[model samples]
Each structure stands twice: as structure tokens, then as C-alpha cells.
Target: MSDTMTVKEAARLWNLTERRVVGLCREGKITGAKKQGRSWQIPATAKKPLDQRIKSGAYKKQAERLPLPIGISDYRLASSQYYYIDKTMMIKDFIDERPQVSLFTRPRRFGKTLNMDMLRTFFERSEEDTSIYFKDKKIWSCGERYREYQGKYPVIFITFKDIKFDSWEMSFEAIRNIFAKEAIRHSELRNSDKCDEIDKKAYERLLSGQANEIELSNALLDLSRMLHKHYDIAPIIIIDEYDIPIQQGYMKHYYDKIILFMRNLFSGGLKDNRHVSYGFLTGILRVAKESIFSGLNNLTIHSVLDNKYSSYFGFTCDEVKEMAEYYGVANKYDELCAWYDGYRFGKTEIFNPWSVINYFHNECEPRAFWQSTGSNDIISEIIAQADNEIYDRLTSLVNGKSFTTYIDTGVIYPQIKSNPSTIYSFLLVAGYLKVLKTTPSFNGDYMCEVALPNKEIAFVYHKEILQQLNQIISPSIAVAIQEAIFSGNHAKLKDLIQGLLMQSVSYYDSVGENFYHGFMLGLCALLSGFFVSSNRESGNGRYDIQLKPKNKKLPGILIELKAEKHGTEESLKKLSQKALQQIIDGCYDVEMFAEGVEMIYRYGVAFSGKKVEVMADSVSSKETIRLSKSDYRSF
Candidate 1:
């Protein structure tokens, strides 16, 4: 529509001085600005940059906000002790047209455990009467059709969320301990009048935490029977984070052993087990049917693709709006959306609930909450081990582009080594990627288009890529480069680094010094025999990277990186030589000189796509020689 605003108009609209508005336009924070005779014609739709300054106020007592429940899994405790956005109505959905076995798979910390705990509270036939906890909750208002079922069933709930162990034996111990704890929960089973004699012995063994591995395998199924016998009704079973052992197995190289045990445990409890009235299991990925589910039947799976329980796993827009209003940060809702929104659970657009809570907890200041929670080693490993095809796909993803692949939500971990598509599927399920759209396939899986969901996740991926580059670049290459640098072979070192950058191009675009910073650091890191540090304070400035020989006999290498955005051949040469000059002027080698490192090799390398320039020289405090640059590119 050719809608435009003048600089003065922009200033008024954005609530800033005209000079400030013009500065923002020049800085490109205000997009679509064009200069027109000492005035900036800005896009009418352009918005002001968010002010990040922390507001200071007079000391005054304020009404305390109920704390954001960070990591508490018990819904009862979280709801009572902290500010909780209610998800209790999930109980109503479960009770209404219940599935025989419903498996809800979502990424970690999307309220799976808390929801399972809520289910346990609602249905567990406990002496403590949990109905009081739900008295004011959403489900209680629906009358007896829902209310009648409250506290009416024997619930067998167990979470394997933290079942990680180093050894199969230790993993079994974890399983055994879980069984023993559940036995204590239902200790009534130990003295059940209807329980058989041998069952009593096994129950005691399980309670004593001394059960054999075979007994532990049979524990959950047998517990259901005992609960049924004790309560005279079938038990509702909830197994939360069901893939922990399998995931741990995949990572720790004990897949077959854990798979065999898990296959038996899940099958025995849920597969045609007459003692279980129904079952609910939650996991991040639905481990493929042939491997884990085996011959089990009557299981209904709800992934992010399924609409029935979409809002159950993440916060809906309405829910977030309600929260923002209640928290008095309703005005900052757009900021929240920019960081945490765009996760899709079925038809519902979802916000990451964990990040939302953390934002409020930190007084409405937004940060990357979810990215810092885990190691995310899986994502790093996948990229580090990626084939050329996988690397190309990842590069596109990092560039804010979407691509389509056949998504089998049932990811078999072993297949990831051969099938690049499975890596995408794993990433999608693991909360690293988001599905943009999906089309039905003949095989019943979806042909899904996916991209990085938000800025926070993308930032983490950027960091991981830098880390992966550092890990993947060879130690031999680093050694070779070290020799080249110290031996006055600047040309050889430059070629080695350039080759590494070109290799990384298949996975990540060498966009700027940001990427190149990691490239240089990665190479130096492989030479662990030396003291290698990045961006440390020295002399007048922070250097790109510094290499000090641990042997103290070798000269230090000071590397400075410059990204070539635009330049002629002459300008490119000038940039590389200028970088070398910047290192000397900034005294980047001050630390090395003080430590009595008598010699130094300062190299300034500049990159422009595949074309690169290197200007390097060996310098000491007294004499600086432009190390025989016959083989190097000249400025």
C-alpha cells in the first residue's frame, strides 16, 4: 500500500526523540527505512526496538507473586506451593471416552510428569484422600460423572524419568529401587489377604529391594495384580518417561540388554494384562513398535501431531494470555512470544511452558531457559557424525529455512546412523525442531516440513555447531597447522585452516567472524599439548585466540579472524594485513611476552566465502620479520 512515515512521525509513534529514531533507522533496527532529503522514510508497520534497560524504583513493599515452580513434579505441591496454570482438566479428557492404553509422547519438561502425578492424585485410592486438592480445580465442577471417579481407583504410577545409569547392572538396580518404592506405596499389598503365599515372598523381596533381575522384570505386571487383588478392581497404570532406559541404552551402548528387559516390563504390564484396567505412558520419542511395543495391541499414541491432547502438553495462546494478564506483564506478551512461541502440538500453536514460568520468575526478563537445562549431546553428536546429506540439511535449518522429510515418529535409534531422516525425526521429537506442516503418507506416517521453532533454540544450535566443529576438526590437522605456524610455513597453515572451513561449509555457512572464531578455536583445541584460550583479556583488547606452547620451547601463535562481507581483491588483501596490524597495535601477545615466551607468530586470516587471504609474520619484542611471504597472498 506504499504506507510510509517520516522521521518525525516515526519518533512520535515509537515514543523517542527524532534523533534517536533516525539513529535506529541507520542501525537497521527499524527496517524498511529509506533516506529522503535529510529525513528517513520508514515503513508504517515498523516497530520500535524493545528497551532492555532494567527499571529502577524506590524501595517499597510489593505483593509477592507465588513462586514459579521450577522442577517440582508433584502437581499437588506445585499447585499449592507455587503459581500454577491449571492443567487438571486433562483428567476430564482422560475419563471421557478413555483409551485402553494411551501413550502421550512429548519433549521433556512439557508437564508430562506433573500431569501423570495429577492423574495419580485424582485416581489413586489413597488413605490421605486427595480429593481436597482438586476441590477448586476445573474437573470438580463437572459434577458426578467426573467427580464420582475421583479417588475411586487403585492407581499404579511410576516414573522412570531419571533412570540413567552407567551399567546395565546399575540400571537394573535403578529399576529395582523404583519397584521397591512402589511396593512401599502399596505396602497394603504385602499384607493383602487375597494375595498368594509366593506373591507375599516376592512382594517382601521387592520391598526389601533385593529382588532378582527376573523378579524386577516381572515387578510392574505383578504389582498390578496385587493392587487388583487388594482393591478387588483392576489398577490404572501410569508409566512416565518410559523411554529413559532405552534412551540411556542407546547412549551408553547397552541397547540390546535394556531393550530386552524393557520389552518384557512394558509388555507384561500393558499387553493383554487382565489386571490393568488401562495404561498411560509418556515418553519423548515413541520407540518403534517392532523393537519395544512388539506384539502389544490396543495402544493409542498421541504425539505432537495428534489434536486430542495438544493443549495438555503445552500452554495454549489463551492460557498464555490469561497468565500474562494475571502476572501484570500483559504488555510484554509479544516479547514472550518471540522467545517461546511457535512450538506446535497437533493443531494447537504452543508456547514452551518452562520458559514462560522462568520468565515470570525472573521478573519478566526473557532468557534462554530451556536451552540451558540439558547437555543436548544428542543434537551435537548427530551433527558431528552427520553425512554430507545430513550436513546440508542442517545448514538449511540453521539458515532459517524449512525442509520436508518423511517423519516416522517411532524413531529407532540405531537407524539414525544410516537414515539421515531419522535424525530429523529425533530432533523434531526432542524439541530441537518444529513441524511446520504435515501431509498424510500411505504408510500412515507424515511427510513433515520442519524448521527451528524459535530464537532461543536457534541460538543453542549455533553454539552446538561451533562446538561440533571444534570436535570434528582433526587433531592431526591441528598438529600439522602448529608445525606450519612455528616453522615459518604460513602458506601451509593457511591452507589447512581454509580446508577445514570449506569442509564445515557443507554443514554450516561460514557467515562471519562468529563462525570463523569457532573454526580457529576448534583447530587450536586439538593441540591440547599447548595452552589454548579464546577471547581472553590481554594487552589492550580481547584476542581471537592465543596458543602458548606447554613445552615453553615453541613460539606462541596469536590468531585474529575477520569476515569478508564486501571487498575488492585489493580491499580483501588490506583486510587481512589490517587484522595483522590490529593484533600488534592491540598488543594481543602481552601475556605470552610476560611469561617469557621469546617468540610469537601473529596470523591474521580473512574469509570471503571460499576465497580467503592470509597475512602472517613471526615477530619478537625486538625484531619483526614478515616471515617469507612468497607463498602467502600479498595485500
Candidate 2:
């Protein structure tokens, strides 16, 4: 080999394009390379230079090639500057259907705000040619008919996603500001000769944020009328997260005020309003019972169960596959699917777009990204109100089971407590559960078989759903109980369980073993490094509870619980002993032993009303030896 090589030879050897090799040589990245005339020479033994190009937004040129847009909701910025998934086909669908008023009900962070912004960018007139954003998109290839609508209409856009407030006053102020922002956007109409003088005055008041309650309630209608007169084309109105304030109101005890205001606002702007050419609304719930869309016969709602425009909200299978390939994590597609996929919108299988994008952005490591993005207040409320039946079903879901129930996609906030069965409906709409099968019910609802969506949701379920139990059972007591269990401090564990029982349970809730089983399950479910299982066959019979460690070095745990109906202390001790014997007699340790766990802690717990008794022993596979109280240490 020669001491020096040409750029072409170096390019071949280093697997670089000749242009890149030449640039590297000129930039002094290729050691000992000299330019001969217009060609460069590199040392034969010189290795490929380390890639020093920035991947983050530290430089302008590098920002053009940034990672996935994790939290970006601005359409123009996301579509042009990030690895955007083309959802513009939704525009083509909308143009074809041409519904006068459309409502899209989907869970939060499922791209509602971004899609709304995409509509605003495509429809709103601007001095800058915004057509460039969609010219290379899926909608552009549909036909000139769809493309002709681009940059053609005045747009009134506002998002209530950030309007969460604790009181009606603050919430009303935030909503007023949102309308004022839209009014300012259409400032040209304030001085237009075509707009009526009264309408111009209303517009100026709205722009100045001095509009009264009645004026603000009619803000959307008034603004659209002025825009239509100014531009000679009725403006398209887009409201993103329209139910956010309604939810906040329901949660904060001012439901009536917000509902009244929203009803007036929506009815004026969307119902029988000639000034509005089209209306688009996105939210997590349909909120039908609220009468906000009262008598709006023209309104059409597309929810998670509907097939129309379903694939637009969340990433479809092919989209995720392409994304995985683009990010060079193709081999992790199955893992990604198991964690973020399984969301079925209509008949389209969807992946949580937020988690999927964050999955790739974090180098393909899976996590409960979707759960961490927002408050789970609704979920917490659901768990807080769960009866024994609902808690057991939720437990089944976390254990990889599905159940069939009637799902009213239009479920309202008030039904959460009054109609406990509506919890499934809430779970499905709020993105906590996924439908595996659907049958249209008699009324407008559906009979659906639903389960936790994926590993991410399962993790979220185990954490949030179980953690809410701490409100009844103090968090410190729960942690102490978990520590006692792991450390084999039977005395401490017994006292903690007894204390929790007295403090948390009502007398009616102490009647059966099922209640205690669920209570113990909730506690055991919080174990960080264990895969908790319940009522599973081990050897000859099913075990009440089993805590199998993910790491082999950690000891496994088996629990058998017994509940007595009004018993003396001596009888409770015997009952607890029987529970302990049942564990060994049932051979519950077979599963753990087969999994190569060396040590096991077997526990027997009994309850009589608030009174309780507990017994525990340890087993080692290497030798059948008992762990005396003096031999105990934290593991």
C-alpha cells in the first residue's frame, strides 16, 4: 500500500462518499491529508474520522436535522423542521366529507393540538406562502381540488389546553385571553369597511380583552362574521382541547358556570351560524350531557370507536415501522410495539404517538412516557371511586386480562361516581384501556372487550392505580409494610397490616377474604423489583399471591390470606397458621423454585374485622432450613 492515497481510495476504504472525504480532508479531520490540485490525498493507514457533526440544535445547520419533535405542537415548525409524520391526508378526508361541524374526541397528547394547528396552517391566509408546508405532504398529492383550499380562508384558532384553573374567575379570564388572541390575529377586520360598525366595536373590545361575559360568549360568532365580511369568505373555526375547561370545572366544583358559558359560546358559533364555513373541535371527551352542543343537529362527532379519521390522531403501524427504520432501531420494533402499540382507533391499530416519539428520542429505551406527560387526575378519580368489583376488574386488566363491557363514548364527568359502570367508558376514552373487540350496542354505545394497552400502560396502571390506595392507606405505612415484608420482620409487618386495616377499611369492607386479598394485592403490587401475581396455579392449587423478583438474587415471596367472620384472638392465630400450612401444602413455591430463585419468604395473614394475625417462614432451595427471627436481615 502507498504512504498516501487519493480521495476516491480513501472514500472507498472509509466507506464515505468522495465529497464527504474531500470535505473531511479540507476541514483537517483526515490526518496528514493534503490537497493535490483539486483532489485530496490521505494517509493509507488513516482511520475514518470521528463524526463531530452536531445532532442537537446547537447550530443552525444541525438544527435542521434534529431528533423527533417531543413536545412540539406548532404545525409549521414541526412539519418543516422535525421528523414529522404526514397527517395531511386527514385534510383530504375532511374535504371529501365536508361536514359543516366536526368534533374529534381523543385522549390528551394524541396529537390533537398539532393536527388543529396543521388545519390552521393549511387554511388560514398569510402573506408568506404557507403552501410550502404541505406541498410535499400527503394532502398535496390528492389533487388540485384539495390544494386549492390552501391559504384560502380566514381562521379563528384557539386552544383551551392550557385553560386549567381552580376557579371560574381564573378560567374565564384564560378563555377570554384565548379569544383575544384570535381577535388580534384578525386585526385587519377591526378597520374593514365591509364589517358592520357594531361588529367592529365588538372586535375591538375582544382584541382589547375588555369584552364582557355576553360579548365574550359571542366572541367566536362575532369574529367569524367580521372575517367573512372582510375576506368575502367565511372563516374556519378550530378549537383544540375544547373539553379541558369543562373537565377542570367538573373537578373544581364550578361545573354549572363553565357549562353555561361553553354552551352559549359553542351554540352561538357552531349552531346555525352562517358566518362559519366549517367548525373543528378536538377534546378528550364528547361531554354530551353538558348541553354545550345543544340542538346542534349539524354537529358530527368522531370518537376513538369511530372508523373515520381514526389513524390521524395516533401513529399507525406502518408509520411506526417507517419511523423505527428511519431512526435505525428497526430491530426494536417488536419491543416498541409491545410497549407503545396496541391502541385501536376504529379498526386501525395505533401506537401512542407521544410515547413512540419519546421512545426514539431517548434512544429506543421503552418507558411510560405517555403517563408522565400530563396529570392523571381523571384516572386518580376513577381509582378513588372504584368499588370492589371495579378494583378486581382493574386488577385483572393489569394481569393481562380483558373484559367485555358497554362503552358509552359520550360519557360525562358526572357519571363517574353516579354510574360506576361508566368507569370502563372513562378508561377507554381517556387512553387507559384499549378495545380488543367491539359490538355496537342497542343505544348509541358499544359492547367492547378492553384491556390495558401495552407494557407502558401496565406500568402506569400498577403505579397510579395502586398508588391512589395510599390515600386511604398512608404512604409511610405502606412503605413500612413493604419494607417489613422484604426484611422478614413479621412483627412489624403484622402491626402495619393491622394498623392499615383499622385506619383504612370500613366495617362493611372487612367481610370476606376477597377484600383482604385485594387490599394485600394493592400493597404487594407496589413492590418495585417484583412481578406480582395473584391466584395463579403453582403446583396443585392456585396461590393467593406471589412476588417473583426480576433479579434472581432477590428472595421471592408467597402470601396466603384468610378472613374470618367474628373470631377470637386464639381462633385468628389458628386461622393464620392454617393459611401458612396451605401455602406449603399447595406447593406454591414450585413456580419460584423453577424460576431458579434460591430463597423464598412464605407468609400467612388472617383478618377478623379490624383485628389481624400474621405468620411467616423462609425456605431455601439449597437446604430446607428455617429463617429464625434472629437470623433476619434486610435483603
Candidate 3:
């Protein structure tokens, strides 16, 4: 069957979209395909090009296309080879403004490095005409003003992401090594005939990694100076993930040492440096307290809240829509939105590029791909420090709700410890939460509504909640409490719960009824091996908890907790009895009856800080049975 086909015919024969078929023909990934005129000509017998989709068994099923740009940071490779989303216009915007020093702080895995690489590729004069890289991109249409700036200046690009280390000395060494590598790349500067031997010797020392701290601190400033001397133009400085070391430093206990070094390096390179034309720095946190950008007077910071440059890092709605249509998954748009959308950056709603790519590549099945890349332990640590009010707010967020609070974008390590709510800023900038709405409050600070970005980030909060409970309540104590509840040892259960409650109050900083409700939820985790459900709708109303034992012979359990206002014996007794009565009136046990359980244990616990009153009873043969003297307590 020797037949020739146009791109449209070829797309139908291959069961791929025409645009994707064209990409394959252009990249030469599809064999025996050729581009002539405005379209491509392909053999009718051509097979579909293989990619990550093959792993998902898409080829066997047939009719599949995947637009996944997986971790590729090289701008040329991504645009020329893969189906890259068009973010090249951001380069035009940057060159147009040309801020002396621009800091773009965004979350991890949000395409920050790739966008920075694209910027460096378009501007840096590396003895290569990289204008060809953007010729077909959107920046190409920006006309001569932006095009003339391409590859016209020397570039000094570096990343401090590798500064992640356990010790300060080791981290310093790692940074020195990064400069050394850059020096080796620019070793041609040593070979310049105009260079004298002494100046060349200084460069050799840097290449050998023999340069000390002071020398390395000024390394970038020195490099830019040398580039200016050689090329007769100031260089563009691009730094990616400049705060990784600082963030790691805070976590690893060497914040002071790293902050000082980073501050010096940034100061020398950025402040009053005549050889620097424009500079860009991308990091997760702004590092405000350390004065990392203190000496640079021309610095402009655009954070997550900023109206400018927000859509550059993450995928906008239109971008994702076009991508879904291109990949022939237009029907999956709603599912995609629920799983990966909800980030409101500036005026645009954004989608997680990392997760979207992973989903399309893996047959469009949803999974938590971004959170697994990093532990998010830093934000969780700060969440664990939350008081009862903040804890309830976080709980509401995990339950698919939103909360408004005063947000301070300039979060530092010290502030996280002093004011725990500073974690909101950290979490916001770090991509664990997204701002829904923002309005200026009377105090002059913006009140912002934040929520979990999507189901993926919701899991992060859920994990944090469990982590907080684990951090506060001991596993051994949990087991003892479980045994007491199982054995009907009311006294032991009371002692254990009171001890746990006091610990939460004094040590964990928990308070109010919300704290008691969460504590009771944690206690109910012991019944997870059997059947346990929390705050779920059943029968006539929502029950606090319903536990049906795995053993058919054992009694099902229903628990209701009431937070008492005063800890008097009379008040506690009345509250406990009222809680039990409400549980029955609400038909909380109707779920158990429907499940065919023959017997049931019902409990009403009244709590006020460390003090608690317990009342429990048994239900058998469809009759409410009074508790014995041992099962009832009011003190």
C-alpha cells in the first residue's frame, strides 16, 4: 500500500491531531515524513511516534498524543524538540522594562528555571546567535525593538540551588565549586590575547577552586567586570533559586552563616556594579530579613501577589485549554481543573504545569506528582506551630473551604518562629496555598482569602494535619487510650484523655472547643482498623464519629463531644447528658442499625481544658439500656 498523504490525511491515518503530526514531522521524530509548501507530506504506512505515552499503554490502545515537557530546562531543546507552551513573550516584557535587578519569587516546580533559561538564552551574548531560538516563538512578533536586544550583551548566569548541604562549611564549599565551574566555562577569558599574565593568574586561581571566601564572594561581580572589559558592554546576570540555600539553612540550623555569605555575594554583584546592565533572581522565599538584597537600591520584587509577571511561571487557563485540545483530551478539562487548577496568580487563574504534564503523559490519570518532589516539611513544621484558631482555619481549608487573613509576603526565618501565621506567607509563596481574593483592610494591610489550590495541595494540608496530631499526641499514649476504650475501662480512658488534653493546652498551645473536637477525632483514629468515619452524613444528621467493629460480635460505637463553658460538676453533668440526648435525637446510631450490628456503645464526653465528664450507655435488643455506676462520671 504505497500511498502518499497530506498532513491532515496522515493525522487521520496515524490517529493523531494534524498539529501534533506537524510537530513530529518538523522535529524529524516521525520517519519518512517531509514538509513541503505550508504543510507536511507523510507515508500512509507511518506508525505513531513513541513517547512517555507508550509506558501508559496508549499505543496499544491507539489514538493518543501527549504534550508533556518533563523537567527540561534548556530553552532551545524544549521549544525545538518538545511541545513547549509559548512563554517566550515574557522575554519581550522583561527586555522592555529592563529592571536593574528583578526578583521573581515563585513556588517549586512552577517552570521558574525553564523561564529563566529562556530569558538568558534570548539575551546573553555567549558568542552564539541565539536569536534563532526565538525566531518562531511569540517574541518574534514583538517587532524590531525587542529583536535587536537578542544576544547583544555578555551574560553571567548561575544557580545557588546546589547550596543545599548539612554543614555551613560544606555549603560554602559547594557554592565555591559552582563559581569554579562557571570559571572553567569562561576559561576562554583567560585566553584573550589582550589579557595580561597577572590578571589571567587571578582567573586561574578561581578555575582551580583555590579562591577563598572573600574572593568567591566577589566572584560574580568580578566576572561581570571581566565580561564588560572584553565585550565593551555590561552583562545580564541571571540567578535561579537564589534562596534554596537560605531555606535549607533555616531548616538545617546554619541560617546565620549562609545568610551572611549570600548577602555579601548578592551585595557585591548587584550594588553599584557598573558592569551589570540588568539582573534577574528567582527563588521560593524573598529572604527579606537577611538583607540579601539590601544594598541593591534598584531592586524590584514581584511576588505571588504581584500583578505583573504572574502568568509567566505557571500555565494560564488559555494555555492549558489549548494544550488539552491539542492533545485530544478536551473532554478532560473539568477533571483537569479539579485536580490541578485553582491557583490565582495576579488576575489570571493558573494550573500546575508539572502536574498537568504528568497527567497528560500518564493517560490523563490524576495523581499527586508535585508534592512528592519535595517533603514540604518546612511549611508543615510551621503549621504544627499553629494555635487553635489557625488550626481550625487549616482544617477548614483541607475540607475544601477558604479563609481570609492578613498576609505578609516578606516572610523571614525569624518571623516564622515569632509569629506562626507567617507560615501563611511562606505557604502562599511556596504554592501550598493560593489566594482567592484580596482587599485592603483598614489597618493598611491586604486581607486575603486563601484556599488549597486543588486536590493535590489539599493532600498536603491533610498530611500536615496528621503530622501535627502525631507531633502533639504520642503514639504509645494513643495505643493505651485505644485499649482503654476497647476494654470499657472508663477510668483509664478519662485519665488518658485528661492527660492528653492538658498536654495539648500547655505544650501544644491548643485551646477552645475546636481543639477538643480535633483531639476527639485523633482519639477515634484507634478504630481505623475496624470501621471508622468522622463527621459524615448518616441517617437523619451528621455524626461526630461512627465506629463499627470488624468483629460482628462486638458492639458498634458512636461518640459525641461537647465543649463545656465552665468546669463545675453540675455544668459538666448537664452538658454530658445533653450531648447523649442530642446524639439519640439525631439518630446517630441509625447507621449502625442499618449495618446489622446487634449491640451499640454510645458515649457523650464533656470537655473544658484538662477537665472532662464522661457518660456512656449500651443499646441492646432495640432498647436504650442505662449505664452501670462504673460507666457514668461527672467530675
Candidate 4:
């Protein structure tokens, strides 16, 4: 009640460690009053509690009306009020239940770093200017018990994301610079008697290129302990993106060496440091604890597959609904959900927050906005390694499929080999594909059949595949095939088909006599802006080639080819009969079919030892037409 309050009184009022309260006074992160000789006091104003000061209507308006910030650097502003649901109440409880090392793994952009940042803000005491950030925020709404724990501890927060570089020296230097900047910022650490000994000796070792793994780890531990000793507080350690080194190392094939370095570094600082209050670590992958954490036996792990904290790291369904409403796109909620909201972890269903935010910013007209994030490098790798079976699966996905797979974190690597099934599986997990069915596979595994979830991914898939094929197949070959089909150059087409056969793998040998037949089918598949299907069901049998051009009125061609098994004349006659039968069976209307046609021109080509013969017939009037090689070539 008096101007002077003992450390015990401050601890009881704030629900903080007496060590923490005293540390705050020493570090100048808080202020109140000093007793005549030995104890500390609090100003009457400080006794009202921080949360009470934040409850005014004015603060609520300020929090709501603030402009949305732009770019990644401004995520704090945009994310401030978005109340990530309390799925991690257990994680918070875990932090409070006992002090030990904890590791959590989730995929990229899953909010691991954000959760760590929130923890740091909650425990580390802030000056007036910084404390204003939390006024009327969702964390404050948790009530007085949480508020009482605010601004009560010293936190040493480190994120490994910036440590990425092509070389080991660059990575080490980046980490050193980060620690140096943080050390300069902490007043107690900078001004303490041990400051000269720690900074000069440690930094000299780093800059001189003489610090080994053990020395570097020891330096950091010494810095942490010195800060705690000078401030009378054990520090809470938050390590974000702990698996970054492993990821980069794997891609660069420096895994064993980097693992050795990280193992020693982490173990030294986190394993037995008595000055550590607690630790929280997050990464995309979970290396075996024996390999990474070593003797840190107190470590606990939370993974994406675990039901415990799923809602903590991703945007929930209700959050998406609220976002839609907030952005005036409420009507499009169902469409958005169909594309991005099907991922389930435990009881929590989540949508990719990055994609949702992208849609809000672009005001996209109901499409796959997330595909623009980056090229599917892993998918390309899979495709490059795919065999015939894998190729069949890719075709199945494009045509439509009912199978999906969950991708564990570390399973995808930079140089991972591409296969059709693997690429499709990656796409499914990365939000490019969505569930089409919950069918049971033959092996008894429940399969979520998936297809391209939105137009964005479909477009990318089409573009990239076509681009790769274009590079592989000669442009002259592609042009020749197009000219052959459009001009009805059966001889040149037959010759080209033979050439393709010569270049193709041995699998096509059995169907060699039908080379032109298969070539036409392959051409249809290669053409862009046309819906191409082979052996599609007609009235009674199947249509050999069905080409629905992108532009209406541009003639959807249906063709049937024959070999010279019977005589060339008889084959032509048979071809004409078959073409007419196809027109009738396909239900082609002779009148009112299209502008330039009563019935589509049906072509029946017969081949005999490089001497190609063509016969064209009109089904509307029962007309048969034949042309010689010179005339056909001129046409």
C-alpha cells in the first residue's frame, strides 16, 4: 500500500518469481520505487495491473482502426487481432506445469515462429512504449491470471532463419552478428562488469575465425549466464526454426558436419545450463533427439500429427469465416474452403493462412491464389525421375483421381527424385490438390482421391509440363505434326510417324504397324487449348480421336485410320464406310452442327509400306472423294 513495496509483495502482485522482479529492476525494463536501504517499492499507479489499464474503450478503438500493414516485415500489424484459437492451451500449460526443454515440429508457414514470438512478448518485461502494443489485444482478454504473468522474465529469443548461406563461414557470421546486436540492446548485459570479458573475448574469437563449435557454444552460454547473474534472473530461451540448419545442410549435402556442430552447440547451452528458466524450440523437421538434443533427456516433442496443439499453428475454420466476413468476401467463403480448408490435424481443420491473406490482398476472383508462392521445385524433381507407372499416375491425376497422401516434414528434400505419384502426393499436401473422395484402396489404406484444387495450380501444371516437353521435342517436329493434321497430309504424317517410332522407346514396337494411329493420339495430347481424349465412348463403340478445339466453330475433328491389310482400294472403301458409321454412331447432326458444316469432315486414311492413301467421305450427302498424291500434297 505504501510507496515502497518489498520484492515479495511485487512477486505476489504480479505472480512472478522474486528473482524476475528483482531482475526487472536491475535491467531497467520496469520501474517503481526504492526503499531507504535494502528493499524495492511500487508506485500506486503501477499497482492497478497492466491489463486493467488496457481495458478502456479508447484502446479497443485504436486497436481496431489501425491500418493494415503491408509486406512481410509488417506481419505483426495484420496479425495482431486475429485471435489464433487456444489449441495450444496445453502448450501454455506445459510451460507452466514444469520447466523443461520442448520441441515442436510443423511444416513451413505453420505459425511456429509466431507462437514463439508471442511467448517472448508475454514473459519479457517491456518499457512503456513497447507495452502499449498489447493494449486491448486478444492475449489480454484471457483475464487477470495471464495478465499477472506478463513482463516478468528475461527472454533470450533466437531465430535460425537468417543463418542460411551458401557457405559455413557466412552462416556462422550471421549468427554471430545477431547475437552481438542482441547483446548490445540489453542494458544490463552491455553495462555489467563482465561485459568487456564476454564481448571482447567472444567476439574476437568469432571475428578471428578461430572459434570452434565448443568455443562458440560456450561463449553463448557464458553470455546468457552473465545476463542472468547481473540481473538476478534465469533466462527463458526461445529457439525458432531450429531445423533450418538441417534442411540447408541436407540440400547442400553437409548434413553430418552441420549436425555435429548444431548438436554440440545446442547441448552446451540448453542441456545443463543452470541459468536457463525454460526453453521452447520449433522446426520443420524433428531429427532424432539422440542425434540433435543428445543428453537433453527432459525434452518433449509436439508434432503436426499429434492432436495436442494443431490449432495453435494454423488458421482454423472459424477464423477463416471471420476473415471472410471482415474482408467483405463472406459470399466466397465456401469457394475458399473448397480450395484451401481441407487439411485436418487432430480435431482442428486448418486453411493455409498465407494463401488466405494473399486472396484478401489481391481480391482474386475465386481461384488458387497460393500457387503463385513459388515453383514446385520438388515436383519437377519427381517428374524428372518418373517411370511409366509414375507417368500413368500423373495422367490419372490430370484426368481425375481419388487418392491423397500426407507428407511428413522431413520427407521432402531439395534434390528429391521426381515420380508421378510422388509429385501428385506433394501437390496434394502443399494445397495444389484437394480431396475428391474417401475411398478405400485395395491395400486397405483409406485414400483421399485428389485433383487440382483450383485453376491456379492447374494452369501452372499445364504450363510447366508443356514447357518441359517443348524443350525436349524439336519445334520443327511439333510444327510438322500440326501441319500434317490440319492440312490432312497423310503421307507426310505417315513418314513423320515412322520417324517418331524410330526415336521412341521399344515399348511402342509391338504397335509399329499402327504407328500413325498412335502418333495421332500423341499429337492430340500435345496440342494446347484442345480437350483431347482417345477411345472415348461414342454410341456403341469408341471414338479413336476426339478433338474439341478451344475456340468454338474451329472444327472438332473426329478421325479413323486403317492399314493396307485388305487392298488399298478396299481399305479406302472400308474407311469410308467406317467414317459414315462413326458420324451416325456419334450422333453427329448433319444439319445445324456448325456454321461451315452440315456434318464434320470425317477422314479415313489407309497406309501401305510408306504409300499412304486417303479417302474422304461426306455423311450428309453420302459423297465419296479421292485425291492423288500431287493434289493431296498441293492441298
Please, what is the TM-score per model?
0.73, 0.71, 0.68, 0.56
Winner by TM-score between candidate 3 and candidate 2: 2
For model 4, the run of ten residues with the poorest summed lDDT = 52-61
What digit string (tens of lDDT, one per residue) describes model 1 on residues 76-177? 898788877788888888889788899899987788988999888898887887898898888899888998888888988888877888788889898889
Could you tell me which residue pairs clash in candidate 4? 5-41, 381-418, 382-418, 382-419, 383-418, 402-449, 403-449
Ranking, TM-score, top scorer first: 1, 2, 3, 4
Q: Pick the candidate with the highest TM-score.
A: 1
The whole-model lDDT of each prediction reads 0.77, 0.83, 0.75, 0.56
The sequence of per-residue lDDT tens digits that candidate 2 reaches over residues 1-635 is: 57989888886675445656776788898789887787777888889887442221221222344568989999999998889999999999999999999999998889999999999999999999999999899899998999999999999998898988999999988888888888877778877999887988898899898888999999888988888889999999999999999888988899999999999999889999999999999999999777899999999999999999999998998899898777655555656776788899999999999999887776554556776677777777767778877766776675457899999998999888888889899889989899999998988689999988876777667666766755556688888989998888889998887777677535434357755676677677777998775655577666878888999899999999998888878888878878888887788898789889988998888888888888778898897654444443321
Per lDDT, the best of the predicted structures is 2
Model 2: lowest-lDDT 10 consecutive positions: 53-62
Candidates 2 and 3 compared by lDDT, better number: 2
Q: Sorted by lDDT, highest first, which candidate order results?
A: 2, 1, 3, 4
When 1 and 4 are scored with TM-score, the better candidate is 1
Runs in model 2 lying further than 4 Å from the true structure: 1-65, 470-474, 481-635
